[model samples]
Every structure is written in structure tokens, then in C-alpha cells.
Target: MKKAIIVGSAISVIGLMLVSCSSTPEATTTTTRQTTVTAAPPPPAQTTTTTTHMSGSGY
Candidate 1:
């Protein structure tokens, strides 16, 4: 029982140390979590032209 208690405490301390040691850099961590999105602008208005030609002849 005593041995188990000592071992458990040691493991807990080691885990805490590892967690504290592995923090990500500020820039790197922020970039990975950042979300960037851009939407395309609307297309310019289109103009359509229609032409009609008519010929008149006596039938």
C-alpha cells in the first residue's frame, strides 16, 4: 500500500511536468486555430444586345 502511494504521486508529478513543458508557441498556436474565409465579389452587370433585320418584297 505504501509503495503504491509513492508510485502514484511520482506519476502524477511527472504528468504535470510534461503538460507544463509542451505549450505551443503563441504565433503557431494562433495560426493553427485561426479561420479565414473570403467570398468572391459579385460579377459586373452584363448587357445584352439583339438585332433584327426585315426585308419586304411583293409576293
Candidate 2:
């Protein structure tokens, strides 16, 4: 009975150690993207003109 208990304890401890020391899987791929935008042109300039008239007779 004592030998059976000792063997069982040893097996349990070895199983726990194996589980703790195992390696896990990881991701190895990466992705990236770039974008561009265009702006509109400015509006054109404006011009104005004025005229005046005079009479022959004075007040």
C-alpha cells in the first residue's frame, strides 16, 4: 500500500511538471494599408466698374 501511494504521487508530480513546461502556439503574420486624398481648387477673382454724367446748365 505504501509503495503504491509513493508511485502515484511521483506520477502526479511528473505530469504537472510536463504540463507547466509545454510551449504554446503564436501568430506569425502582419498586415498594413495606406490611403491618399485630393483637395479641390480655389475660386476665380471678380471685377467692378462705375460711370458718372454732367449737365450743361449750372444752378
Which one wins on lDDT?
A: 1
Q: Model 2: per-residue lDDT, tens digit, 19-47?
A: 87785446667666666776777667666
Where in model 2 is the C-alpha error above 4 Å? 23-59
lDDT of each: 0.85, 0.80
Runs with alpha carbons beyond 4 Å of true place in candidate 1: 24-59
TM-score of 2: 0.39
The ten-residue window of minimal lDDT in model 2 covers 23-32
Full-model lDDT, candidate 2: 0.80
Clashing pairs in 1: none
Clashes of each: 0, 0
lDDT of 1 at 59: 88
Where does the lowest 10-residue lDDT sum fall in candidate 1? 24-33
Tens digit per residue, CA lDDT, model 1, 1-59:
99999999999999999988887545544434567898899999998998897879868
